[model samples]
Target: MVEQLSLLAGEREVDDTAADIADPCEESGTSVSPMLPPAPLNGLSPSLERKRLQAYLALLVGDVAILLAAFYTVSILYFGTLSNWAMLEGGMISAYVILPLYLTVALYNGTYSRRSLTEWQTSAFRAATALVIAAALVNLLAFFAKSNAEFSRMVFALGLASTAVLMTAMRIAVSRALIRKWGPTSLNKMVLLAGGPKLNLPHALHVNASEHGLEPALDDPRALDRLSKYLRNMDEVIVSCRSEDRAAWAQVLKGSGIHGEVTHQLPHEIGAIGVVHYDAAGVSALKVSSGQLGIRARVAKRLFDATVSGLVLLIAAPLMLAVALLIKLEDGGPVFFVQKRVGRGNRFFAILKFRSMRESDDNGAQSTSLEDDRVTRIGRFIRRTSIDELPQLINVLKGDMSLVGPRPHALGSKAGSKLFWEVDRNYWQRHGLRPGITGLAQVRGHRGATDTETQLSNRLLADLEYMQRWSLWQDIAILAATLRVITHERAF
Candidate 1:
C-alpha cells in the first residue's frame, strides 16, 4: 500500500521570499503587492458581463427564431400560403436537429473566449468550421431518420450563414465592450524558481517572466534540502551551474522525492526521466520545453495588423476628425500629441494620441492616472471614453500601429520598460509585429496604471494569443469592438 503525503517544496518557499525582495518600487514609490487573491469573476463588471450573458442567451433564442423565420420564408416561397402552426412545426423540427450540433462545435474551439471574438475573420472561420461540422452531423441524422428530402439544403445553408453572422457579430460586440471595460488584464499562473547564481539563472528567468509569464524569485542552492515544503507551488524547477553543483542537484531531488518533470543547466548529462536540452540566452541548459508562439504565426500576425489598420483608418476618418477638433477646442493646443513608444524589436516610434493632458503638464514619460492633477477636465472625459486615442488611427495608417495587436507602451512604462528588454532577454519577443491601436489586452480592461508585474504578464499573454492566431477579419472585428468600448467609457 502507498501512503500519500502532501508537502510544500522548500525551494518554492525560498523563491517566493526572494520574489518579494527583488521587486523594485517602480511606480508611485510604493511596493506593489505580489500576493493577489484569485480575481473575482462571478460579478465581473455588469456592463459587458451582463451583456455577454444576454448575448449567449440571445444566440440560443435567436438561433431558434431564425430557423423558424427561415422555414416560414421558404415555405411561403415554395408552397404559397402557410399556417402559423405549420411554421412552428417546421421550425421546431429543424432547430432540434441543428442547434445541438452548432453548440457543440462552438464550445469546442472556444468561439466564446471574449477576446477571441473581436477578430471577425477568425470568428468567421470558426463559424464556418462549426457550421460545416454541424451540417455533417445534421446530414447523418437526416439520413437515419429517412427525412433527407423534407428539408431543403439551400434553407439549411442560408440559415447557417445567417445564424453564424448574427452570433459572431453579437459575440464580437459583447467581447469588445467587455475588454474595454476590463482593459486587457487577467490573472496568470506564475511559477517562481530558486537556483544558484553561477548559471546567470536570474537574468534568464527574468526574461521568461516578462514575456512568458514565468517569474523567478531568488536562487540559493543550499535551500534545496527543504524542497518538500514548496513543490506544490512550483510548476517547473531550474537548477543552476550543472558542472560544479552536480552533487547538490541530486541530493535536493532525492531528498524532496519531488520527481515528475524537471529542468536544469547541467555540466554533464544525468539522463533524467523527462528532460530536454536547449540553449537559453546563450547558456547551455536542460529545460523542459514549453511551447511558445511560433515564427509563421508572427508573420501572419504582422500581415493581419497591416490590412485591418489600413481599412479602419480609411473608414473612420470623418469621425476621427471630429474627435481631433473636440480635443483642440477643449484645450487650445496641438490636436495630435506624439510621444516615443517602444515597438517590436526594441524599435522606437512616435505613438499618436488626442492630447488629453494640458500642454504645461509634461512630466517626463509618466503614466497618467484618474487622480493625476495634470489631466484637464476635457482630457479626463476623453480619456475615460478612450476618444483621446483616436489619433492613433494615423499610426495604423503610417504602419506604426496595427488595427489589432498588443497595445504599445511608452519607452519608460513602469510595467515593462525599454530597459526591461535590455535586462530580460525574452522581452523583445513581444515586438514580433507592429503595435496595435486596440488589442486583446486593451479590450479586456488593462489600461492606465499597471502597478504589478503579474498584471503586465497577463497583458503580454493576451498579446501573444492574438499573434498565434491572427487574421484580417479578426482585426476588423476588434476595431468594431474598440468603437463600442470607447463609446461606453470603459477605459480611463
Candidate 2:
C-alpha cells in the first residue's frame, strides 16, 4: 500500500496536479515493479548526535563558568582593591558570598541556555529583581542571625553590580561566540516542499519552518531524497505542507520510520507556534509556543518606554547637559551626534546620542573602542558612565526607538558588507521590532566595540528574545534595573 501510494505520489511539487499510477496487478501482460526509493532521514548520526550534544553542553557550561568567574574576579578586584570592607571583613567576603549568590541567581535564571533566559530587557529585569530579592532576603536573614554587621552593603551592592555586568557581558559573548561558531539556530534541518508564490523557496521555507519553530534542513525539494535519509537517521521529519500529494509524502515519511507532521497544523498541534527551535535532537524537542507581541503589548511597551525614558531623561538631563557642555568645550563640535541606524525591518532612522568622540567620520563605520583616540577626556568619563547615551531620549520620544530594545547598529555596519543578517541570513530575523537604547547587548556587556562576529551574534540573540517575548512590565523593570547599571557602569 505504501509503495502504491509512493508510485501515485511520485516526485512532484505538492501543489501541482496529482498523478495517477495504475495498479501493477491490473496491467495487461506485463509486470510492474515499484520505482520508489528507500526512505531516508535528514538528521545527524548517533555519533554526530552525541558529539553535538556534548559540544553544546561543553560550550554552555564552559563559557558560562568562565564568564561568571571573570565577573567574580573583576568585582572582587574593583571592590576589594580599595581599603574598604574587605580590610574590615578580613577576607574577600564580597567575592566569596556575593559571587556564589550571583552565580546561583544566574543559573536559576537559565542564563546558560543556547537561547537566552529572556529578552534583554526581560532578562535584565529578572536579573535585577532576582538580585534585589536575593539581597533583601539575605540581609534579612543576616539581621535575624545577628550577622548583618559582618557585611557591608557597599561591598554587597558592588558584588551584585559586578555580577550583573560581567554575567551579562559573558552571556552576550558566549551567545555571539556560539552563533558564530555554530551558526544561527534558524538555519537548521527543515525541508521545503513548496509550490508557488504562496510558498516560495527562501521565504516560504523561512516562514513555514519559522512558524513551526523548526529550521528546515534544506530548502530544495531536489534534495528531498538526501533529506529523507537525514530525517530517518534523526528519527524526525517535518513535511511542512498540506499538498494534493500529501498522502504520498506521508507514505514515504512513514516508510522512512520517522515521526513527521505538516507545517500548517504545527501552531495548534505542536504548541510551537512562533518560538524558534534550533538543533533539536528529537520530535519532542521540536516543541515551541507562539510568542506574539500583539497590539495591546506594543501599546503597553511604548507607553512603558515613554514613561521610563521620560522620567530617566528628566533625572539624568542635568548630568547629560553637563556632559554635552563638556563635549562642546573639549572639541567645540556638536553636542548631540546623530547617525543613521538600522532598526526593525531594516528601516533606517536617526539615532541621537551625546557625542562621545571628536566629530569626525575618520574610521568610516567602525565601532569605537576604549583606546580610540577620537574619544575626548570628558567623553571617556561620560561613556564609561553611559551618560553619553542620554540624548537617545529624543529617539524614544520620536518613536524611532524604545527605552529597551536591541541596540541599533550603524547604517554601514556589516559582517564583511553583508550586514549581520546577510552574514547569517538569520540576522534580520531579529529586526522585527524597534531598536532600543540599552538592550540585551548593552546591559549584558555587549555595549562596547563589536570587533568580531561572535559579539554581534550574541547581541542578535538578546534582541530576538526581546521581540519574541516582551511585555510592559518587563519594560518598566528593565528601565529600573538599567538605572542601577548606568549608575555603577556595570554594563560599560
Candidate 3:
C-alpha cells in the first residue's frame, strides 16, 4: 500500500473524488496491500517551488530579450545602422552597463517574481520604477567615471524610454497569458486529502486510511512512512479525522514536510469552540500553529533587537559605569546579579541586572517586599527608578531575550499564594518567545510583583495577546510606551 502511494505522485494533475477515510487507529495493525498496483507515473511535472523558480527565470530571460530587442531596434531607427560596427560596440557597452543594474533593481523591486506574474499591475509599476532607477544609476556611474562623453546621449535616452515602455507591455501580456494558462494561481497545486469524510472537494485526491492500512500513530513508523510517501510532491495534505484522531494527524502533518491541515468537526460536535468555514480552503480546519513569526519577521526582529540594544548600551555606558560604582560602594558586593530565569522554549538562562538586593544565602527566586531590608540603600534607589533592569540590555544583546516580549520569570516565582504556572496553565505558553527587558504588560503597569491571581492573569493575558498580534511595529510601540511607565508606583 505504501509503494502504491508514491507511484501516484506523478499520475494525473489534481483529480479529486470522495474522501470517506476509514477506521479507528490501533498499534501494530495488519498490513493491507492495494487491490491493484498503481500505474507507473514516471512523467511527473516539477514541484510548485521549482515551477515558481523556473517561471521567475523565464521572466528574467524575457526581460533581457525585450531590453536587447528594444534597444538595438531603437538604435537602428535612430542611427540608421542595421549593421554598423559603431552601433554594435556601443550597444555591447551599454548592455554590459545597464543589464546588471536593471536586473538588480528589478529583482529587488519584485519585478521578476511570483507577485509580478500574479498581479500584473504591481509588476508594471515595479518594472517601470526599476528601469528608471537603473537608468539613473548607470548615468550616475558614468558621470563619476568621467565616461559619459563616450555614449550617444539621444540614442541612450530613446533606448531607455522605449525599453521601459516595452518591458511594461510585455509583462502585462505575459501575466494575462499566465492567468489563462494556470487559472488564478501561478501553479495549479496538487492536494491530497488523508482520511476525510465526504467533502464537496473534487479538486483533491482522497485516500481511505483503514483500507490502505494507514494510521496516525506516531510510534508506528511503518504507518508514518506510508503517509509520508502519499504526501510526497503534494502541495497540501489535509487530514480529516475524528476528534480523538485529530491530534495524531496533526503530529503526522508536522513531520510530513508539506503544508498540512486537520479538519474540524461541526459546531455541534466540538461545542463552544465555534466551527466556521475558511473560504480560502473551502473547509473548516483547526489551522494548527506552526510558528508565531515567519522568517522575514524573525530576521527583522533580530536586527531590531541587536541594533537597539547595541546603541542603548553605547549611549548608557557612562551611566551604567556610575551605577556599577554605586553598587560596589554600597556593600562591596558584586556589581551585577545573575538570576536563573525561564526563557524561550522553557530553557533556563542567567539574567543580568544591576545588583538591587543584599547578597544572601537564601534562594535567588525570592521576590523582594516593598520595605525588604535585603535591598541595600543604593539598591532601593536603583530599583525605584528601574535602573537595575538596564543590565538586561546585555541579555538582549546576547540573544537570550528580545527588546519586547514576555518578561522571564524565576522558577519559584509566585502569584499570590501559588506558583506562577500553578495560577494558570497557560503561563508556560508565554515562554514560546524569548523573554524581554520590558513588555506590553510592563508598559501597562503590570510589573514589579505578581501579588495576586488577577495581576498574574492580566500579565499572562497581555503576553499571549502580544504573541498573537506580534509585529516589529508593535514591539516599537511597546518600547515607546515603556518610557512613560519607567518610574511606576510599584517599581520598588
Candidate 4:
C-alpha cells in the first residue's frame, strides 16, 4: 500500500512539472497564437526604426530651438534690442559654431543615446556638461579668430548660463513626460527570459522588468520555436538556466535567429559582488573582490555628511525647538523619542526623532498604521509633513547616520508580524553604511511602515542598489528628491 501511495505522489509531481511549462500565451495573455509559428526573427521593423529616427529628430529640433531662444533672449536683455546687428551677428555666429559642438559633446557623454534619461539628475548633468564644453569651445574659436574683443563677455556669459538652464530643464521635462506616457516600455527593449526554474526576483526588480517590457518564455520543447517567430519583437534574450544546461540553452538561443544579443543570468547570490576578474589558466577561474570605497572616498563622504548635517541642524534649530515644545505641551511626555536602531556594521545607535506617538509600553515594536489610534493630533500633522524626523539631524551630527543612506529600523521592527531580518537574509546588508534620516528607498516611495514582505523586499533592494551605485552626486540627488517625496500622500 505504501509503494502504491508513493507511485501516486510521483505521478502528481510529474504532472505539476509538465503544467509549469505549458504554452505561455495562456498565462501571459499575449495575442500570439500557440498553433501558428512565430513571425520570422529579424532586426527591428522598418516602421519601428522610423519612429525612433523621428523621435531623435524631434529632440534635436527642440534643442536647437532652445539654443536659438537662449541666444536671442540674452542678446535682447544685454544689448536692449535686435537693432544691435553687430551683437546679433556675433550671437548668430556663436550659435552656428556651438550647436554642432554641443551635440558632439552630448553624444560623447551618452546624453542623446543612453538609457539614463529616466534619471533626471544624470540627464541634467550630461546636458549641463555638454553646454559648458560648447561654451568653452565658442570662447576658443573667438580667440583664434582674433574676434574676442569684438564680443561682450557679459553677453557670452548670459548666453551660456541661459542655454544651460533651458536645455537641462527641457531634457528633464521631456524625459519625465515620456516616462509617464509610456512607462518603462519607453525604453524600447523587449527582453525575453528563457530556461531554468523561475527566479524569485525582488519586488522592485519585478516592477522594473514590467516597466522595461521584460517577458518570460516558458522552458518547454517549443520555446525555441516560439521564440523564433517573435524575434523581431524582442531586442534581447536573457537565458536563465542551471550551469549544466547553459551550453544547451546557448545553442538554442543561437539557432533562434534573433539577430541580437543573448545574455545568460549568473547565480544571483554568488554574483552579487561588484568586481570580478577571470584568470585564463588550464581551467577558467574567477576572483571576486569586495567593492568597498577607498580611504579617500570614505573621508570625502564623511566630510560631506558632517558639513551638510551641521548646516541643516543650525538652520533648523529654532523650528526643532518649537516642535519639541509642541510635543511636550501635547501630552507632557518626553519631547524626543530616542530609540535603539541598527546602524553601520550592525552596531546599535540611538536615533532621535520628535516624539510622534503617545507614550506607550509597546517599545515601538509594532508598525504604525495609517489610522492608528495611538497617534496624537500634533503627531499626525508633524508626521505628515515629516517635521517629526527633523531631530534625526542630531544623529547625523553625532556620526550615527549619514544625510543619505539606507534608513535604519528599530531593533524590534516587524514586517507582517515577522522580524524584517527574518523576512530577508539580505536585510542586514543595508548596514554597510551609516543609516540615514532620508534614503534612496524613502525618495523612491518605499517610506513608511513596511507591513508586508513585498514592502520590506522592495526597500531592501533599493538600499542595495544605492550601496552599489553610491556617488556624491547621487547623494545630492537623493536629498533633492526628498523634497518631492515629503509631499507624497504616503509620507505619513
Candidate 5:
C-alpha cells in the first residue's frame, strides 16, 4: 500500500488531472492496510526522562529565587530596611500570593516551553506580558482579600519594575549558559520528513530549519518500524509529497503520535505572511495573506499618526517658521514645495516639504546628487539635517501620510533608466500603507538616491518587512531612530 501510494504520488506530480490516479485499495478485493503501528512507548528510559524533568524544575526554582530577590531588593530600597513592619508584611503577602500567580501566568502563556527557552527574545516578550497581566491580577486579588492595606503602593511598583528587570536578566543568563553548554546547533528539536525521493525542497528550508534548531531526518516510507523509532525523538513530522499521497502519509503520521504538517516547495520570493482556513460554500479553502494590515490596525495607526504628528507640529512650529523664512530668503521661491507623490492605495497626493532647491523646471524624476547645482546654500544644511522633511508633518495631519511608513516615491521615479515599478513587481505593494516622513528603509541608511536596481530592491524589502511586522511600539522606535538616521553620512 505504501508503494502504491508513492507511485500514485509520483504520477500525480507529472499528470495534472487528478482523475487519472487510481486508488490501490479500491482496485483490490482486500481492505486497506490497517493503520501504521503506534509509536514506541519507551523511547527514552526512566533515568533520562527524570533528568529532563529536573531541568524544568531547576528553571522554575531559579525563577522563584529571582522573584524573591527582586521583592526583597525593592522592599529594602523603598522602606530603608527589610525589617520595616510594613515592608516585612508586604514581602510575606507577595511571596505567598503574587509570585505564585505570576509563575502560573507565565506557565499558562508558554513562557517556559522549549521553543520559548531557545528563542530568548520571544520568551522575554511573553514573560513581560505575563508579568504585566499578573501584576494587575495580583492587585485585584489584594483588593478582594482586603489585604491591600498591608502593601505599600511604592513598594509594589518598585517590586514589579525590579522583577521585570531581574527576570529578563535571568532568562538571558540561562539562555546563554545553555547555548554554551549545548553548542547553539545542538539545542534544536528534531523533525522528520516523510515523502517520495523526488520531492524538491528549497535551499532556504534547510537553512531556516538549521537556524531554528530543527534537525531534519528523511525517512523511507517502507520502513515503518525504523520510521516509528525516528518519530520518538522528533518534535514534528513534515510530509512533503504530492496531494495524491497526502492521505497515506496522514495515516502514517497519525498513528506515530507526533504532531505533523504538510507542505510543498515554494518559490523563493514568496513569503508566508499568515495562513487562514475557511469554508467557501461547501468546500474548504486555505488563504495566504501577503502582508495586509486589518481594518482595526489601520484605524489605530491613523489615530496614532494624528496624535503624534499634531503634537510634533505644535512643538516645532517655531522651528518650521524659521526654516520657511530662510528657504524663501535663499531663493525667493515657494515657501513649501508641493509635489505629487504616490501614496497608499496607489493614489497620488501632494507631498509637502520646505522648499530647498533653486527655482527650476527640472523633472522630478531627475536624480539629485550631493553636488547638484539646483541646491541652494541653505538647502545643503537643511537637507543634511533633514529639516526639509519637517513640513511633511502637515501631510500627516492631513491624513495624506503617516509618521512612520514607506516613504512616498515621486511619480516617474526611476532606478537608472527603468521606472521603480518595472524594477520589481512587488515595488507598488509598498504603498499598502500610507507613505511616511520617515520609514524603516530610511532609518536603515537606504535614504539616499536609489539610482540602481539593487538599492531599490533593498529599500523595497525593508518596506515590506516593516509593513508585515507593524506595531505601535515599532513605529515609535523607528521615529526615535530617525534622529540618529538624519545624521548618517548617507542622509544627504
Candidate 6:
C-alpha cells in the first residue's frame, strides 16, 4: 500500500512505459478544455436503492422500539411492579437521551449501511459500539447537568447492558433474514477485461472501455459523461487496463462517484494506495482514490468552516455594513459583487466579494493591476487591504467555498496569452476542492496579477500540493499564515 501516493508519486518515472501513467494524486501537467460535471448517474436502479432505504428505515424503527422496550421493561422489573407509574418512569429520562445519541452514532458508523444487510456480525458490532458510546455520553451529560442523582445507578447499568445484548442479537437475526431474502452479493458493478485472462463476473455488466468512452483524456467532458452513463446504477467498477492507463481510469472513476479498481499484473510498477485480492477470481486489483476527502474528514472540515465563518462574520458585520454603504455612495452601484466562478467538481457557483472594480463589462477578462483605472477610491483601499474578500466568508458559510483550498478564478482569467486551463491541463483538477477565500497560493505570496504562465503554474502547483497534504491541522496552519498576508503588497 502506498499511503503517501499523493505526495511521492509525482516524481519523474524511471522509464518510458511509466511515463504514460500520470499520478492521479498530482497534476498531469497537460492542457485540455475544462471538464464538465457529470450528470446525476446513480439511483438509476430504483429497486436496489429503494430496498436499501427501506432497510435503513426499518432498522431505525427497530432500534427505537428496542430501546423503548428494554428501558421500560428494566424499569418495571427494578420497581417490582408495573402499577407504580412514578417509579417506572425513573429510566425514561436517560432512555430518551440515549435513544437519539445511539441513533446519531449508529448512522455515522455504518450500522445502517447496505453492508449491514449482508454482514450480520459487522452490523451487530457497530450497533453495540454505538450503544456503548451513547450510554457513556449520557452518563457524562448527567454528571455535568447535575441530574445524576435523579436516576438510579443500578437501573442505568442494567438498562444499558440489556439494550446492548438485545441490539446485538436482534441485528444478527435481522441481518441473516435480510441476506436470505436478498442475494449474497447485493451490489451492482461493471467489469472490464484484459486480453490474457477472462473474468467470471456473472452479475456485472461487461463493458468495452473504448465504447463506453474511457479515454486517457481528462480534458474531454463528452467522454466522461458517456462513461458516467455507463456506470450508472453501479456500486463498483473493476477494469483491466494497461498499467499506463490505470491513473487516467482511476481519475475518471473517482469523479464518477463509483468505487474503482484496476486489475494489476506488474504490482511493482504501480503506486497503488492499496491492493485488493479477489481470491475467487485469482487476481489482485489496485484500489483507486478514496476521494479527495473521506466522509469524516469532510464533516470535520465543514464544521470547522461553519464555526470560523460564523464567528468572523459576527465580528466583521459592522465593517461589512460600512463597506456596503461606501460602495453604494461612491457610484450608486451594487455593494456586493457576485460572479459565476467554476467551483468544486467544475460546477458554477456565484462567489461573493465586495465590489472592487468599477461597474464595467469586466468578466475576469483581465487581471486587476496594482493601479488599474477601473478601481474606485474606496475600491483601491479595500483591494489593497484584502478587505474586498471579506464577503467570501459568506460563501464559506453557504458551503459554496472553503476557508482554505484553491482560489477559484474567473472563466475569462488568463495567464499571459492563454486562458488558465489552456496554460495547464491540471487547472481543472484543482477544483477537486472547494475554492477558498485564502489558500496556500495566497499565503505563499502568489496573489495579485498573473501576467505570465509561470505565475498561474506556480499557484496551481501549490493548490495541488495543498490538496495532496490536506488535513485539519494544515488548514489551520494555512489559515494562521494567511493573517500575515492580509495587508501584503501583493494583495492587489
Question: Best candidate per lDDT, number?
Answer: 6
Residue 41 shift from truth in candidate 4, angstroms:
63
Candidate 5 on 408-448: residue-level lDDT in tens? 88755778887776787566557657899999998888977
lDDT of 4 at 439: 88
Can you write out model 6's per-residue Cα lDDT over 1-492, one digit (the tens) per residue?
001111012232122333243221123232323332222233223235456667778888988888889889888888788887888787677788899999999989999887887787888889889998998899899899998988878878888888878877887787777756655655665576533234446555565444323454565443443354445555667877776777777666554434678778655245344587665766677777444775457778999999999999999999999999999999998888888676765555678889977854335877777767888999889988889999999999998899998998876788898888778756666766788998999999999889999999999999989988899999999999988889877655
The segments of candidate 4 whose C-alpha lies over 4 angstroms from its true place after superposition are 1-291, 360-363
lDDT of each: 0.51, 0.51, 0.68, 0.61, 0.61, 0.72
The alpha-carbon deviation from the true structure for residue 100 of candidate 1, after best TM-score superposition, in angstroms, is: 36
Error of 5 at 263 (Å): 22
Q: Estimate each model's TM-score.
A: 0.39, 0.41, 0.51, 0.43, 0.45, 0.63
Candidate 4 CA-lDDT value:
0.61
lDDT of 1 by residue, 1-492 (tens): 001121123212123233332221222243334542111111111223334445445555654575556555654554455666565455445556777787788767755434343454565567567777888988898999899877766556666666666656655675565445434321111222233333333211211212211122113111221122233222233444324443444333322212222335453355343343433433334442232223233346556656765676778788777877787787688877777665532344678787777753222346566577777777777778776777776777676676677777664556535333333334444554568878877777665666666667777777767766666667667777766667543344
* Model 5 error, position 452 (Å): 1.5
TM-score of 2: 0.41
Off by over 4 Å in 3: 1-287, 360-365
Deviation from truth (RMSD, Å), model 2: 22.7
Give the 10-residue window scoring lowest on summed lDDT in candidate 4.
Answer: 1-10
Best candidate, TM-score: 6
| TM-score of model 6 (CA atoms) | 0.63
Look at candidate 1 and tell me the lDDT of residue 435.
80
